[model samples]
Target: VNGQFVTDNGTNIFDIYKEELLKNPYTAENARIAASHYGSQLFDLAKNGFDSIPDLVLSISYQNGSLQDIGQKVNYGVKKTID
Candidate 1:
């Protein structure tokens, strides 16, 4: 999924993604991993200006009612100034 974050939007991308993860049953273990990874990335991005946010990629697989090697790729566009 592609998303954009603007300061005045009052919406946090990470929070929405975390909620989605919680709602998905097949994403138990990988969800935590993804959250941690993305959370760190977000922190880093926030620390240096919102520019240069990269695409997040992870490997994910579901087998026998279990998730294995879970991964996902998402791109986010952050606009520090809104017109």
Candidate 2:
């Protein structure tokens, strides 16, 4: 995929995640607790196993400034087959 498309998609994903975190009470609270519990998990995961990993999610940080402006885009598709 093109860089422009990836950037736009990444921004969209960020917006959606932020919106969901704001809208969902449980998510917001759990995220706060997770931040406290897993302070460096995101960075660790990123550094250790980013490309080799699959279906992993990392959150952006506001206070620590560690992952303030990071973004990515994943491209996949669904296939339907008849047996």
Candidate 3:
């Protein structure tokens, strides 16, 4: 592998691909990995940051923040398990 999945500067999945990973691929259907070695992927980003899980729950319980807003903070986006 040209680069690692986890790095000291955090993970940037795009940089690890050496062969122009998706530079010339046609856009069609849901994306699947070229190789089946990896199990899962996570893409997490924050602009305003987030509070702990307990604090976040409290915020939602009290109507301090909307689910959409809280989702932006703690996104549990995609979960897939392949055989």
- Model 3, span 1-83: residue lDDT tens: 23234557775454454234445465222124642223222222122223322353433322324232353445432342233
Candidate 1, residues 1-67, lDDT tens digits: the string is 2244434567777788888987899876589898899878776676665567666675666555655
TM-score of 1: 0.43
Off by over 4 Å in 2: 1-19, 50-83
How much is the lDDT of residue 32 in candidate 2?
Answer: 58
Q: Residue-wise lDDT of candidate 2 within 1-83, one digit each (tens)?
A: 22111244365333455457657877786765555455455445545655656785664544332334235353222342334
Estimate every model's Cα lDDT from 0 to 1: 0.65, 0.48, 0.36
TM-score comparison, 1 vs 3, better candidate: 1
> What RMSD, rounded to one decimal, does every model reach?
17.8, 18.9, 13.7
Q: How accurate locally is residue 16 in candidate 3, as Cα lDDT from 0 to 100?
A: 56
Shift of residue 75 alpha carbon in model 1, Å: 26
Candidate 3 — which residues are off by over 4 angstroms?
1-4, 12-15, 24-83
